[model samples]
Target: MSFEHVFKRIIEFMHADPCGNFRLMVGTDSQVHKRHTVFITGIVIQNEGKGVWACIKKVVVPRKMTQLHERISLELSLTEEIVGLFTEERKNELIEIVLPNLYKGATFTMEGHIDIGAGKRNKTSEFVKEMVTRMESMGVEPKIKPNAFVASSYANRYTK
Candidate 1:
């Protein structure tokens, strides 16, 4: 579906009084093959009591992402590219219309869920802090690991 259409659907879902409350999340994940790679970007709206609503799109990169940092960068870049479709004015309109109190003093755009996280055996842990820092600098809120289901779960599924 078109990005604008998908975005509108998300806004509509948000305004539908979804079991009282909901959080909007977006992210990307990738699966590498010997000669190519597939990336999946997803948007997930988690309602307080009603079930979840989601959408996804997949694209292929000609080259494999063999390096950890390279993979992380591609995931982050793809997600950012998708999110770029959501203009600031429109996002604020949704916040004003449906999620006024939810974000309080925050910027209130879709939360980005990065696949990187902290842990001993998790190599992606090394990029967690750096990725969070960069995303914050760009005025975005980022989540990872257990809280990053939009990327680690939703996006990862279609990447396979």
Candidate 2:
């Protein structure tokens, strides 16, 4: 979908309950196939426990991506690309919706969910610091593994 359309939807969702807590999450995951690889990036807006509006953008590589590091980096790059679309002006617009309700406990957070984990059993563990640093530099809180449902779960489901 176009950025305008997605932004419209997000505004509508936040306007529904300006006093509600909201989280805007972006994540990407990739699946290598016999002939190609599919990458799916998920953009999710969760109004705390109230409701959510989400979408996915897909990118397909012409050849199988076998290098683990390369695949992981590509996934993160895709996620960052999406996050970058929400420029400061656009973010301030979203925040403006809830700004008045801040005194009522309203809050907003933007998170980048990396599919990698720090667990010793996970091969992606080795790259956690590098990826996490990249995400932190983006000015969004970074989440990995069990906490990164957008990349590991939502985006993963569509990579196939």
Candidate 3:
């Protein structure tokens, strides 16, 4: 779907219950095949314990990406591309929905989930700092590994 349509849906979902806590998360994961690689970015809006509206954007690279660093970086780049679509004006629009209800515990957070883990056993550990820094620079809270369900779970599922 187009970015406009996605934004409209997100706004409508938030409007449905402005008083609820909300998390707008974006994540991307990839799978490599002999001929190419498939990347899937997941956009999810969860109204904490209430309900969620989600979507995914798919990109297929013409060549298989086998390098650990390259694939992970590309996944993050794809996620960033999607996050960039939500300009400050658009983000403020979302935050404005729950602004009035802040005193009542209503909240809104933006998160970027990187499909990397900091475990000694994980090869992606080496790049965690770089990816996290990028996300922070974009004004998004960064999540990795176990906490990054959108990337490791949601988006990963589609890569297959």
Clashes in each model (backbone N, CA, C under 3 Å)?
0, 0, 0
lDDT of 2 by residue, 1-160 (tens): 8979998999999999999999999999999999999999999999998989999999999999999999999999999999999999999999999999999999999999999999999999999999999999989999999999999999999987
Better of 1 and 3 by lDDT: 3
TM-score of 2: 0.99
Q: What is the C-alpha lDDT of each candidate?
A: 0.78, 0.96, 0.97
* Pairs that clash in candidate 1: none
lDDT of 3 at 160: 89
Worst ten-residue run, lDDT, model 1? 100-109
TM of each candidate vs. truth? 0.87, 0.99, 0.99
Model 2 global lDDT (CA atoms, 0 to 1): 0.96
lDDT by residue (1-160, candidate 1, tens digit) is 8877887887787667622465777798999998999989898876656767899988898987799899898888887876666678767766775555554432234688898879879989888888887667656688988889999988998887
Regions more than 4 Å wrong, model 2: none
Give the number of the best model, judged by lDDT.
3
lDDT of 1: 0.78
What TM-score would candidate 1 get against the native?
A: 0.87
